[model samples]
Target: MEAMVNNICDIVLKRLYMPRVGILWTSGNHDFLRWAPSGELTWVHYLSGDFTKSSNHANNPCYIVESLTDPYREAKTLSALIIPNISLDFVSKLCLGLPFTAAGSLVFGCLDEQLPVIVDDTCITRWLRTIDPKRIDEITSRLCNLGFIVISKIGSTSSSCVLELDEKGWISWCEIADRLSGIGVVILKNGSRLTDEAEDRLRSLGIKIER
Candidate 1:
């Protein structure tokens, strides 16, 4: 099993050309994509972090972006090159603003439908548009670009925040199982869905997983 895994990794390293880093920091569950801005590809999975150094992976085509927004502080800057492990439940609390599945309603209107996509503070356009009332969903859903979830604060402080998207945008516990079932690049603990067959396929070619 280990030899096969290594061989699969070798193939993936050969197939991915330029690797861009995107960070996913959820409090729970695992298996997500990380985007690398410096590479030919827009984003790469966390597990295949070494793709740039292995085989022809550096030549395989991918997306590229100059900058990214930080989920921790809502700051936009040059993209990060590393991936951080975070918990699932903690992130969901800040993201959905809705606990699990609460009758399809949320503390704030934004998280009701969209799992990720928060009203980013760095971009005035997102903030301005969020308060418009008409485009709240549009604004909140925008967090998808940043790769995080958004939730509104109830009162007192009343600060809206963001949460990172898990492999399948599992901000709510109810969504975690389904997200894990889908194909994800990095096989983190608890990510049983990342079968050997799946890894072998990703090693050889580009794959698109539906949300």
Candidate 2:
């Protein structure tokens, strides 16, 4: 069965061969500093002529693909994918003036258990901070399953949100309260409050919520 599947895939690939696109994920910090793709590649040349001279006028620029004679020649490079939590500010710099298109996904805290999650035009973004339609649509399906409220921020369509966390496990008791006074198995819930001595002991230990 596996051999048959492999053979079928090979046949299909041979019939419709597509260039394997490579993606270098950028860490948002890289936006501050980074160079161009290093490989056996020539400078972008437009068929009409070099558009580098005309800055004020809008020109349709295209790159002339150059063949690499030495495949092993190294052009020290790095991936562009980055962490949103830390690198929110430099997104623009990393994506601006680059040759490639940008796209991204978002995950977040959800609210409804049944619906579980919601993707809107609020959170995600591309390297260039433009909306990417395909990415947004793909994120929608993933969020519904994963339960994250998300959005996008990149492309022609503009940026949009994607997914978020579900509503079930919101918060825990230990999160809000400052301290745990005692470990009594059973006690009157409201009637029994933290005693003065216990509060003092907790305070000494640097606990905020004594009782």
Error of 2 at 20 (Å): 43
Candidate 2 lDDT score at position 82: 19
lDDT of 2 at 184: 16
Estimate TM-scores for all models: 0.20, 0.17
Residues 146-181 of candidate 2 have per-residue lDDT tens digits of: 433232333323222111112233323322122121
lDDT of 1 by residue, 62-114 (tens): 22111212222211221322223333332334345443422112212223322
Task: Please give the lDDT score at residue 206 for candidate 2.
Answer: 37
Q: Give candidate 1's TM-score.
A: 0.20
